[model samples]
Target: MMQSQHPPSNYQNNQQNLDDFDEVWVPNPLGQTQGPAATSGLIDIIKSGSLDSLLTNPWLVSIFVATIISVLIGAIATILAGQRSTELTPEQEAQQALLQKSQNLEQTDNNFREYLTRDDNNSGMVSNPGLLQAATLEAGARYRNRIIASLNNPQNPAYNQHEELINYNSEIEALKRINLGASGKEAQLKYVDPSTGLWVTIPIDSAELAASGLTKLNIISNSRRETTQRFDLVTVAQNIRKILSEVKAARLEALRVKGLSPVASELEKTDWFGNKASPSEAEISDYQQYKPEPIPANPNTSKQTQDKPSPKPTGGQDDK
Candidate 1:
C-alpha cells in the first residue's frame, strides 16, 4: 500500500509532447487573430492535433510560406500596373493644350463684346490704344474679304450693298484728290447721285449761283453737295468703326492662342503707309457722338398740305 504510484508511460510521453508544442507555437495572450496566411497555417497545424505529425511533414510549412509570397508579389504588381495606367499619353496632352487654346479664344470674344456694349462716356478709352487700332484694321480686312466672298457666291443677295460700299469709297477718294490742290480756286464737289446711282460732279461756277444771278438754284445745289459730302464721310467712318470692333475681338483671341500679353503701343504706331494703325480717341468720340441731321420738310409737301382744303367734313361723327 505504501509503494509509490507512477503515471502510465504513454500519458507521460503525451504530456511532454504537449509542452513541446506550446513552446514551438505560443499564440498571443490577447487572443487577436493573426494575418490570413499565418492564421491559416496555424489552423492546419492545430487541426492535425499531433505535434509529431507536423514535425514529420516539413513540406506543409514550405507550401504555406510560398503561397503567401506569391500572393503578395501579385498584389504588388497589380497596384503598380494600376498606377501606370492613370498617366496621360503625349497625344492626349497635345489635345488638352488645343482645347485650352480654344477656350481662351471663346473667352476673348465674350470679353470684347462686353467692352463694345459699354457706354461711350464710361469706356472713353482703353488702356492699350494699339489694341483698338489693330482690331479695327483686322476687322476691316475681314469684312472686305467677306464681301468679296459674297460677291463671288451665286447664292448671296448682298451685291447691291457691296456695290454701294465700293461706290462710296471711290467717291471719297475722288473728293480727296480734287480738294488737295484747290487752295485759291474753289474745289468742285463730286458725289453719287441717288436717282441714277451714278457719279455726278457739280461745277464750281454752277454751285456759286449767287454770282450767276440764280440764288435759289445755287443754294439747292450747294446744299446737296454739303449733305452728300457729310453722308459719305460719316458712312465710311461708321463702317470702319463697326469693322474695328470685330477685329479687336479676333486680336484678343489670337493673343490668347499665342500665350502673349497685349502691348500698349503695338497698335498705336503707324503702319507702312504712314497712317495711324487705329482710330484716334477724337475720331472714336466723334463717331459715338454723331447724330444724323433731321430731314428738312419739303416745300412742296407743306404747300400741298395747306391747299388740301380740310377734307370737306363728312356727315360721319367726328369721334368715329
Candidate 2:
C-alpha cells in the first residue's frame, strides 16, 4: 500500500483511544441550514417578550383574565351568602316578637297577683272574692302606673313595654261589667221563686233587697263563690254560729230584764258566752272540711247589670 496516514503500532500503543462523541461540521441531512433551537421555558418567554408579543399571546392573556374574573366572582358570592344568613325572614321576626309579648304578659300577671295578696301593702283594703276580675284590672293599672312613674324620672333604668300595659285601660273598663266575676268570666246569678215557681236574677244592693223584701240567706242562689286570698271557710262558719248564739242570748236577756242596765252584762256570765257551739278539744272535735255547694242557675234573669261599679276595695283608677 502507499504510505498510510495511520499512526505506527508502537505510537498507537503509547496514546489513548478517541471518545465515542466527536465535534465536527457536516452538511444538513435534509439539505436545509439549521436555525437556533427553542431556547426558553414559558417563564423566560414571558419575561423576554415585548408588549406587542404579550398582547398577541391569547392563551396567556386569557388565562390571566379568567383567574381575575374567578376571584371577583368568588368574592361577590361570599358577601351575598353572608348577608343572606344574617338577615331574618318576616315570619321568624314575627314569631320572635310574639314570644316576647307572651313573656311580658305573663310577667305583668305575676306582678299583679303578688300585689293583690300582699297583706302588709294593703292593710285596710277589702278584697272581695266575687269581684276578682275588677281586682286584677286594678292591680294591672297600679303596675302600669308604677312603671310610668319610673319612666318619667331621668334616673330610671332601661325599661321594656308589655301588652298588659298597652291595653290596660280597655281591660279595666271591661272588668267593670257587672257579670264579670272572680274567674274573669261572665257569671250571672239567679234564684227560683218558691211562691211563683219562676226564676229571678240576683239583686246587687242592700236597698234593692229591702225593696223586694227578700233576705239573701233565705233565697238560695244559682251562683258559687270561689275561694280567694281572704277566704277561710272555717272562720266564716265560726262567725255565723257565734252571731246566731249571741242573738239568741240577747233576746233571752231582753225578755228577762226589760230596760235594765244589767241586761247585756248578764249574758257575759254564761258558760257558753265566749265560745262557739262545737265539741271541746278533748272530745271528737275534728269536723270534716266542707266544699261550697254549686247552685245551678236557670238561664232567664230579671236584671243583668248591678247598680254598683264593683264589689269592693281596689288599688287604682282609669287611664289618662
Candidate 3:
C-alpha cells in the first residue's frame, strides 16, 4: 500500500502519523472520537429532529423531561396496582368475614337501643305497657330473624360460633308463645274462652265489648306477668347491650389476627364494654307504673258477665 508522507493538521495536533491511522477520526460533542458507525447513528438522530431541538429548544427540552417523568410515574403506578390487586389469603378472608358479621350485629344492637330507650310519655320512663311490649317484640324479631339468623347462616364464615344467639332465640320464642294477646291490634281485644276452649276477639270500642268489661278482660288476657319465667323488655334491652360489647370484642380479636388495628374513630368505642346489669329502677318503673285507661261506660251493657260463643281463634292469629 502507498502511504502518505505528511499527516493531516488534526493528526498533527494529536501528534499522530498518517501511517498509524486505520480510519478517519471524528470528534463528537463530548470531545470523544467516534467511529463511522457512531457518526452514522448521530446523523440519524439529527435527521430525526432530536439532537438539535433537544439541545437548543426550551419547549422540546420540557416535553422530553415530561415524557421521562410520565414513563417513571406509569412504572411506579403499575407496581402499586400489582400490590393492590393481590388477593387476600384464606385466613385473611375468614377474619374479614368475621369482622363484618360482628359489625352487623353491633349495628342491630344500636337499633335495639334506640327503640328500647324511646319514652313517648316524656316522663323519663317508658310508662306505656302497650308500647313497651311492642318494642320488646320488635327487638326480639330483629335479633332472631335478622341478627341471629344471619350469624348462623351456613354461608357465614363465623357460622355456629355464637351459640348464645340460639339461646336468645329460644327465650324470645318462649316469650312469643306465652304473650300472644299482647301483640293484638290496639282497636281489638283478644282472649281465650275457658268454657268453650276457643279464642274470642272483640273490638275495643264495641258497646258489646264495653258491656263485657273490656278493661278487666284486657288484664286477664294479658296475664303473662304472673308466669314464673316471663320476658321483660328492659331486661332484654340490657342483655342486647351486653351482646354488643361481646361483638365488639370479637371484632377486635379478628383485627388482631389480621395484624391490624381498629381505626382511630372506633378505638374508643371498642375499648370498653357497656352496662350489662338489669335495667335501672327508672327503667323498671317504665312498665311497672303503667296505668290502663278507663273504658267509657255503656248504659245498655249488662252487669252480668257475657260469655262470647267461640267458633275459632281470631284476633291477631299471626302472633308476631
Candidate 4:
C-alpha cells in the first residue's frame, strides 16, 4: 500500500509528518463545532426557533393547564343551573296547589249560598219557619198518643196511660198562655227627613211621647206596641230554634257515624230509646177549647182613675 505525506499548517499541531495519514482533514463551512449535546428532549424543543409550536406540542404543560380551566368553568355553569332549577320547582308547585284549593273553597261557598236562597212557595216568605217551637203543647200532644199506644202494648214495661194523659193535658193548658202570634215584624213607618232628604226612622222613648213628637203623628196605638213586643218574642223564638237545630244535627251526625239511619217521624214513632209507638192518636183537646182572656185597658187613662202619675223619661239627650 502507498502512503501520502503532507505539510502541517499553523492551526494544526504537527508531531512528525502526514506520511502515515489515510485521509485529508477538511474545515466545516458553517464554522460550528458539535460540543456536549443537550441531554433532555424538552430543553431541545425549547431551544428550537418556533416558540408557539413548542408550547402547542401534544405532550406540553400548557395543554394540561387549558384543559383544567375548561373543566372548572363547565362545573361552575352546571352548579349554577342546578341551583336555579331547585329554587323554582317547589315554589311553582305550591302556587298551583293553592290556586286549586281556593277554587274548590269558592265553589263550596257558592253552593251553600244557593241553598240558602231557595224559596219554593214564593209567598214573599221563607218556606220553612225560621223559628220552630218544640216541647210545646202541640209537641206533647203529638208524643202522648205514642205513650198511650205503648201502654196498651204488652211488650212495654213502663206504660202509665192515665198519668201520661193528665200530664199531657196539663202541658197543653200551660202552652196556651205563651201566645205566640206572628213569626216576624211588619215593615215600620219610614220617613224622609225634610232638611237632609235622607230616609230614616228614629227610635222613640216609651215615656214623654208628646215631647218625643210621636204623639203629633197619631202613631201611638195598641197595635204598634204589640208589634214591637212581637219582634222581641220572635227574636227569642229564633234563638231557641237555633239551639234545637244544633242539637238535632249533632244527634243525626252521631247516628250516622255509628252506621245508623236517623230517626224519621213518618217511619216510626219512637221515644229517645228507639221503641215503636203510635204518634197520630194524641189530640190536643184542651188546647182547642181554651181561649186567652183579653188584656185589660190601663185604669189610669180611663178618666175614673186619673190620680196616677205618668212615667218620666229615663234617658239623656238624643244626639240626633
Q: Identify the candidate with maximal lDDT.
A: 3
Report the candidate with higher TM-score, 1 versus 2.
1
- After superposing all C-alphas onto the true structure, candidate 3 shows an RMSD in angstroms of 22.3
Candidate 1 differs from the real structure by a C-alpha RMSD in angstroms, to one decimal, of 23.3
Model 4 bad stretches (over 4 Å)? 1-88, 121-320
TM-score-better candidate, 1 vs 3: 3
Residue pairs clashing in model 1 are 130-267, 133-278, 136-244
Best by TM-score: 3
lDDT of 4 at 88: 61
Write down the TM-score of every candidate: 0.22, 0.20, 0.24, 0.16
Give lDDT tens digits, candidate 3, residues 1-320.
99879876766556555345423233443455566753454455567776664487565567779999999999999999999777778888887777776676667656556654553432223344333444443444444444456576899754766645554454555444334434442245555433333344555543433333433332232322222113555565555555554555555555655556644224424322221233231121123322432222321232333355323323454534
Judging by lDDT, tell me the better candidate of 1 and 3: 3
- Choose 1 or 4, whichever is better by TM-score: 1
CA-only RMSD, every prediction: 23.3, 31.4, 22.3, 28.7
Q: Cα miss at 260, model 4 (Å)? A: 36
Better of 2 and 3 by lDDT: 3
**Model 3 steric clash pairs:** none
Q: List candidate 3 stretches off by more than 4 Å.
A: 1-70, 73-75, 78-82, 121-320
| Evaluation by TM-score, superior candidate among 3 and 4 | 3
Predict model 3's lDDT versus the native: 0.48
